[model samples]
Target: MSSPQSRFYAARLAGTPVFDPIGESLGKIRDVVVLPQARAAARAVGFVVEVPGKKRVFLPATRVTSIMPGQVISSGVMNVRRFEKRSGEQLAIGDLLERTVTLLDGSGRATVQDVGLEQNRHHDWMVTKLYLRRIRSGSGLSKLVSRGQTLTVDQSGVKGLFGTDTEQSAALLLASYQDLKPADLADIVQELDAKRRIELAEELPDDRLADVLEELPEDTRVEVLTGLDSSRAADVLDEMDPDDAADLVQELPEQVAEQLLGLMEPEEAEDVRRLMAYDEYTAGGMMTTEPLITAPETPVAHCLAMISREEFSPSLAATVHVCRSPLETPTGKLLGIVHFQHLLRERPDRPVGEILDADRHTVEPNMPLSGVTREMATYNLVSIPVVDEDGRLLGAVTVDDVLDHVLPDDWREQDEPPATTGQIDLSEIARGIHDGDTGSEPAGTAASTTTRREGGRG
Candidate 1:
């Protein structure tokens, strides 16, 4: 089998199609796959495609005949059954997806939706187990309410629900919500070498794997992908937010970046290209491609519905925002911003306009640093929107971004401030030690390293 070139996963692949070696249709590419390793690059190897009317299937890198502008060609010879129970890395989606435990009643059961995680985003769901209850409402009004006897048991008991593992003792402490934080799980997953990441990811369900991966760091993320192989990594990145996907590509070496770029859909890759073209410091820089965009006439409820579907990142939860359409002339016009906390404080059903701060402050493209710095200081803004002359919003200037320019990171001072000119302080030596800043101490004479007592000995 010929190797897929190393450059295969240089950019994120979204909306790319998948095919069997004989050119039979399979699914749309969802994520690229890589084979994990320890330190060396994770080999770019395969793809996970969301097949229509069928379960998502994994396509091996070796089977790929060629990756072109719009499609992936492969020989339909790879077996996928082995990947079912594999997990590429240790990730939290397991706790999020489902877990088996013995309920307080002592009957073994599997949790359906983690009510714990829902109420407390940081909840360690393993403690609270919500089971599936079959709806048996047919006869009488009383029938709707169970006498609390008919329990819906999963075809398999608790262990069966989790597939391979047996139920733990009722006394075993479930992982605490605090301990199961994504940041914690991400750190743990990153600790695994590339090989372990691929192995764990392969074992994990493709959909679940995609969710957990969104939290990992760039280098570790690439490791996971490289381990899975280029093709699979490509598909996974496609499903990620465009900004995150661009962040990942920019971190890779140029050679690798170009290779992966070829495997992705043209439009998605182009979006990533535009994002990468900016400096990571300026307003054109650090700006995200994943802005919440809306047409000027878009109904408030309609726009909110789209935002609720996890289209925007949950990590950026409270800051969900919206933008204006391109045809409206002002390129990056601001529709409005919503802090979900404030949104929730009001009834969810209210139109977004009812709560928008119409008079919120905004900045423009050519605004000078002196004005911007003062604006930031006065308003105490965490992020200030940067707009063009027509009130078209372009990008937001985050505090860190502003600092990056005000204080260039690489050129920061250590202990002393940068010298004004290269001129030395000659006056100090000429004036003698007695006249120096150390006023209390006696001045030292040159001959004795410190003249015995001003002039007693020389």
Candidate 2:
């Protein structure tokens, strides 16, 4: 029999087997669902259970007769279907565990190591507290030993969890996500509900929002863009890379696309419109208009400053196109190409024209995808400039853009393991605390703590 005081951290319950009174095995615990109400301990609603043969079903907490270390005895009733997240429901292990969060105390960020749930007098389980581990830095054994100091806080003390709370100010919330790469942040946002996703999109700055939008799938990108007001959507689109902006606008309905294009600056809109004129599979369609260019007589110092000032991507900045007069827009009369490396090795005062590689290869904007791939492969180039018959520079295609065209349509939809702080062993941390392993000190001693407010339901 389980006592009312008995408790289990979410990490300990995950993967534990469930069985019926007669000892017949039913399934394993996959996730614990709870309702996230503000200022209260969240109530455990049920378990997302994985039955044998790989089917996942929901087993309500009411059907759970007893909870123990390694097994849960249940009344055996369950709904046989895929688990879909509801508006009010949150998963303790699946959604909250290992998520990055900020402490209300103004100490820096920490990862949620585990959530503490306890059985009440009525035999109901409620989330009572949270276990946190600080972000750490080091290498080898020292890194393992000095890993984050662990602390426990009542659920009320958590100021915010990245991508989960929309009520907090955007600047505060965005600070937590800044450490995550745009692709990783996009994955987290995609898991959120439509309403939450829209809220997040509204709060992010245009540049940051553009980066995330570029990483999202075409369908999701359209949905998010459509959800925003026209002016804001146009601002975000304008901030995006021209190639990416063109691709996104092309997916929008003609009326909506035209409206957004009109809202953009003339130069920016012209760049996108020019690319849109080409077939999506052709070199012209896949190129970016932001390649580095300079006159042959331009000094190496001037070129270096342009690259640095513009913050051109590594591939685009790797080579500089040298041309005739009117250097800003290289004319079809191509002169030579200068690798960034060669420019650096020469005297800063030297003219780029003297060091240009006259034999550099170039591709036509209308070239087929296959031809582009072969040219890139043959020359082992990171970026190939696109030009017209007049040898005028149009744009450049990067290796990443090429892969995006060649990869499977569902490549972005494939499941990726959730990101986590790899420093601590969660199960071991839970067991050590439960067993009172002072010597091992899985998490550092609890310094300051806050207890849940009495009688409030989270």
Candidate 3:
């Protein structure tokens, strides 16, 4: 049995397998439910378990016998009803995770990364504190501050400083959404209605919005972009990966697309135009126009600094393309490539040209999708540079774009249920509870057991 002093993190508890005393698996925990009225030491009433077929079931916390890493032991008897949200019930994972909260000490706002829970002497689980990460703000600062230190705070601090009002909570919640991974944020957006999605998009900064938009399905992406004002939409598009931006613009009506392009800054618009000119299924269409490039004679330290200063994605940062003199746009000539690993091993003060991968492979802008995939597979490369016949660097196609092309259209829509058992009709269970037909004892009866435990511990 777990002790009253034992503590657990909400992130660690999520998806833990639950099993009966006899070793029969019930389900996996999806979310922890707490009553908001309980305030600072909110009591955790139950868990939302994910059963098979993607259905969710609610399990009262009292039914749990023991909690351990990766597993939960149950008393063998559980209500197998579908889980439904009751008024005033706050979910640790669904409601609190990723929500933003203001610090009492006047420090900048931070997003809730996780929640801390501890069992009291009464045998009741309570919310203890929150894990927070600072939000990065400003143009081109997202990637620079992508990684931040985490801080922990107790509930009393939150209520005293952050307020308990709906508007303040909602604002913080929306702000915290920026910290979520693009894929995770996209999943949440897909589950919301059009109005709510629009509301969320309005709160996100352009760069973050661009990242989330790139992860969304085509229809959802179009809907979100169309919902924003033309200028805002153009700004988001400008911030998006060039290939992704082109794909979106191609879906819009010719006039609207043209208007958006016209609104975008010339350099950004030119990049998109270059991508738009290519066949989407070809190498040119799938490549990002913003490949990291530097002059061959540039110092290694300078190259590293540039890599750190720019907001290139991890894969793009993996290799730096080397170009000859006249290093500006329409790069003088494609010289070679320098893998980041090799660059890091060399003396920082040395010129990058000393260690160029002169024999590096290259692909044409017009190469077919299959050919491009074969080339990447053949070389085991994460990114491949695209060049015109004159050996001028154009752009680079990333492996992620290739996977997106080859994967099934509905791949992103597959159901992902929390770790647990099979499904049951929740309405039937609700009816049973209403008619007093459920074989389980009333909640008050369960509370008495905990009350006794509390008295004994005290």
Candidate 4:
């Protein structure tokens, strides 16, 4: 009801931490839930907050006490139910960005860059400002170098924002979310309806989509992949880790899976095919074929540089597999491995082979998931190497891979209520918010859907 700032831009508000009155962390503001009006500004009813465990729930706007630079203060009476879009509710970042609108003075149309929300005299928040960028035409060198005029205008200065004929795309939305981690971006894609999800996925670069696909649930990954043409789908698959790509391929129909494999480049497809040969529960299936690898003769300095790459996940970079020539997986004999710590403590000029961890354990490809788990636990290692019967390195299985297999199939979905914070009921609090004596208010509801579903901020 009270505020540190009278207005806040939706994009800047996103990912801002939310805190209880006592200064304890609740979660983060993921998005604003707004209801559009025919001739009035859209009313913001609540927010989609991503709480602990990546679970998203609704936070009524009336309960927020202040919007500061890096955080939001709340009354802490949250509705722990998974947030869902009602019949007419629209997500400010998910559904509104990139909407084409006509200028009031008959000026050229522009796309919605961002929207600003502020509380009215009645303490009800509404979208009252818009950031617009003029639409530009043509492509090539000129298009890349030229700039479009941008404006900061009152919401009433633009039309067609909520019209059926308005052209809306995912271009600007994706740009606004460009800084989000792949996992965070995947959360947003999962919450969108099937149509919008595909639209956003199609607009992402192959490499970016590949990273996002690896974080998404199996069904959603498959759905997005199937939405693309075979050529593009294969390209995305190539960009993903072989193990993840194989897992996704297994979820597809046999014929469709084979077709996609054929469309992929021979080298990339070969890795996926090899991974698919083993049972899904075996170490072979869980290990990534693209682990950080180096030849025994490679300098420790070089191995350290390889592990430092941004592309490698922390688990994968924990140790470097040292093999004979043909440093790639399935290389000559698995000589040994050098942990990053070892590489760091030794002289930079030393060869990695001199610093191998003699006590490290290796697992056979056929080893079951249980065996892999025990191997990692017993050795106190972040990852274990998988070697062929002939003593050649096949790949390395990380702790994350084992957890993925051991956890419940639907672990990613946030269907249950959050840990209890208070005894208050959200419905009662919501009712008190709108019943106040406010002049000429637009009618709307904060009621969520009956069927529980997975969702997150966009």
lDDT of 4 by residue, 28-116 (tens): 99889888877678888788898887767788777788888888999877776777777677878867788889889776678888889
- After aligning candidate 1 to the native by TM-score, how far in Å is the CA of 56 from where it should be? 33
Task: Please provide TM-scores, in order, for all candidate models, with all chains considered together.
Answer: 0.41, 0.61, 0.61, 0.77
Using TM-score as the measure, which candidate wins?
4
Pitting candidate 3 against candidate 4, the one with the higher TM-score is 4
Runs in model 4 deviating more than 4 A are 1-30, 37-41, 49-57, 65-73, 79-82, 101-110, 113-122, 126-160, 163-167, 415-458
Go through the candidates in order and give the clash count of each: 62, 5, 6, 0
Model number with the top lDDT: 4
Model 1 reaches what TM-score against the true structure? 0.41
Residues 382-403, model 3: lDDT tens digits: 8999999999988888878876
What does each candidate score in C-alpha RMSD? 25.6, 17.6, 15.4, 11.2
Evaluate model 2: give its TM-score. 0.61
By TM-score, the candidates rank as: 4, 3, 2, 1
List candidate 2 stretches off by more than 4 Å. 1-125, 129-173, 328-332, 416-458
Q: For model 1, how does the per-residue alpha-carbon lDDT over 1-458 read when each residue is reduced to its tens digit?
A: 44333233222344577677666776666444433334432233445555553333455544566666567676655443212223442112222233344444454343432211111232111112234433233468656564233343322233333333532221211222123434334544554456546666655444445555656655676777667667766666666655556767887878878877777777667766865776543454555445455554545555556658754444333344456557222345576666555655665456665566554667764565444555655665556666666777665555544443454232221212333354422233223322433222323322212211111111
At residue 370, what lDDT does model 2 achieve?
66
Stretches off by above 4 angstroms in model 1 are: 1-181, 204-214, 314-324, 327-332, 335-356, 363-391, 395-458
lDDT per model vs. reference? 0.48, 0.75, 0.75, 0.82
Clashing residue pairs in candidate 3, if any? 27-420, 27-421, 28-419, 28-420, 52-421, 82-426
